[model samples]
Target: MKKYTDEFKLECVELITIQGYPVRQAAEAMEVGYSTLQKWVRQYREEQVGITPKASAITNEQKRIQELEKQVKQLESDNNLLKKASAFFAIEMNKGGKSR
Candidate 1:
């Protein structure tokens, strides 16, 4: 694997977390793998939140927790979309029923 400098890694993480660049866009601009950039961002967040033991230390459990958090976020987003779609269809159905 190609090694990246600490400063470079921090800058990339900052681009996503602090500078408001999307992860994928930053990764593309940096010419790094998308997953690699994501891992760096996760590590940065863990450090910022005090979940990580150190800058270079991440336990398997911490990794699992991060993965679970991502899943929960995705599920919540999906639920919101579904709820909106259901409400929209319900409104349309009510309009049709009123016209019948």
Candidate 2:
């Protein structure tokens, strides 16, 4: 396998993480393997978090947990909106019943 410079690896990781390019797209544009770019990103994040590079890896489970947490926040917001709507409709119904 060909070796890459640390600078090149950091550029590739920045393209995906900072520039918002997808990993596959960044890898293809940089002429590197997709999995190689992903590993770089994981390492970059580990370093940012002050973890030993070799000892830290972000697992798929962690990604899933992040996604699930976002979904839960969205659901909670929706439930609150529904509760407000229900209360509004209940008041309307009471008003109409009294008028009849």
Candidate 3:
């Protein structure tokens, strides 16, 4: 499967919803699958109404939330790693001092 950017997906949805383009016609013009464009439109509509999608986000706000959530997860993982390393080095230092 090909990955489409959030901007591209939003533009395609706008072409159909805002620009008065038929879903099938827009799909053909944009070289995307008809069903894919249709799905994007549906998701766009749902997002506008404050629905949080289970799949990848279609709107800018949701996309930012997803990005931030990913960053938070990464930071948490790095923090855990750093804590472990600190504890390991502290133990090593204590052992070395005791042996001197």
Candidate 4:
């Protein structure tokens, strides 16, 4: 597999995204695989809306945003678990009191 620089990836993505070139056309002109260029364009669009890629990000700002978004998702999951546990414990305490 060939390794392309981040700058190269961005330019390829821009050809399809910003410059309105077809993915197939851009890929052919750039000598990149069609699927690969398509993936780059998809990642670029997703990053614009804060959807992080599983692979390396296209931009530095997007990388940071992806990190933060992951952190936020983890925190939210933890909070939800804590809320459920608290509710369960409260219900248990009430059951014990009522049984006494």
Candidate 5:
């Protein structure tokens, strides 16, 4: 419900940068969680350090293969259950037709 303003976020970032407050102290002073403060600090550091752009995310073919494999596994399980049920009913019917 309560959302922080851009100015508040920037001030927290700046306080940590200029005043050199450890994440805990900065978070307490700013009335935010330590983990939240740590997250901001990490993002700041990552931005400063710079990162290479990435490609080669999951391909469509790979996603399709995964989906197909899951479907096959589910169908195989269903087929196995059907086979077991058929065999069980056949045994019961044969017993009824015979004796005992």
Candidate 6:
């Protein structure tokens, strides 16, 4: 995944504002996909009601969500492993052998 920096975002905004470049050209010049730049422009417009010189902002909520998702995935894997281990041990106990 590409990590968009503050400077990169500022440059993109500049391309739109100071340079008077079209959205598609600005996006291409900044080495970002058109949709991504467009989304930023749209968000900046919608959120701030088209305030010129877009803000270089990062939403911490995305990082928080990613961390939470990772933890959930780990917990799920651990639960699955425990279930499998329990089933394996149960099979051993039923076989009349020394249980591990």
Listed in order, each prediction's TM-score against the native is 0.52, 0.53, 0.70, 0.63, 0.45, 0.48
Global lDDT of each candidate: 0.81, 0.79, 0.91, 0.90, 0.68, 0.69
lDDT of 6 by residue, 28-59 (tens): 77899898988776654453443333344423
By TM-score, who's the top model here? 3
State the lDDT at 62 in candidate 6.
37
Predict model 6's lDDT versus the native. Answer: 0.69
Clashing pairs in 6: none
Lowest summed lDDT across 10 adjacent residues in model 5 is found at 51-60
What are the candidates' C-alpha RMSDs? 13.0, 11.5, 2.9, 5.3, 11.9, 7.9
Off by over 4 Å in 6: 1-34, 41-58, 97-100
Where model 5 places Cα greater than 4 Å from the true spot, the runs are 51-100
In candidate 2, stretches whose alpha carbon ends up further than 4 angstroms from where it belongs are 55-100
Ranking by lDDT: 3, 4, 1, 2, 6, 5
Best by lDDT: 3
Query: Per-prediction count of colliding residue pairs?
Result: 0, 0, 0, 0, 0, 0
lDDT of 3 by residue, 1-100 (tens): 9899988999999998889999999999999999999899999999888787788999988777778888999999999999999999999999999998
lDDT of 2 by residue, 1-100 (tens): 8888766887898897889999999999999999888888988787666454433234344445556767999999999999999999999999999998
Cα lDDT tens digits, model 4, 44-80, are 8888887778888997778888778889999999999
Question: How should the candidates be ordered by TM-score, best one leading?
Answer: 3, 4, 2, 1, 6, 5
